[model samples]
Target: MCGTELTIEQSGIPEAIPVEFCYAGWQESLQLLALLTEPEIPDQA
Candidate 1:
């Protein structure tokens, strides 16, 4: 979700609502979310 302004008053939170603490720009931020959500894999011998 991408937009020019931060937020809206009347309509209330447009479709471009980003996840909390995700920030606005920088693709790395999105990647960070993916990494955090990834399941931990056990090491195989």
Candidate 2:
């Protein structure tokens, strides 16, 4: 096995995956801020 330490943000973006892709439990409607769920908004005049 191979792994390295990271502070999440330093790791940048990861490939998108279904929220229900948890290793355990029924996560059909899961939300994690660390996963960068919020939509990007443009600056309004």
In TM-score terms, candidate 1 sits at 0.34
RMSD of 1: 11.3
lDDT of each: 0.55, 0.42
Runs of candidate 1 exceeding 4 Å displacement: 1-26
- Over 1-45, each residue of candidate 1 has an lDDT whose tens digit, in order, gives 753333522335456765542445445765686688767999998
- Tens digits of per-residue lDDT, candidate 2, 13-45, equal 245844334422232333354346666789999
Model 2 CA lDDT for position 21: 47
- Tell me the number of clashing residue pairs for each predicted model: 0, 0
Please provide TM-scores, in order, for all candidate models, with all chains considered together. Answer: 0.34, 0.20
* lDDT score, candidate 2, position 28: 32
Best by TM-score: 1
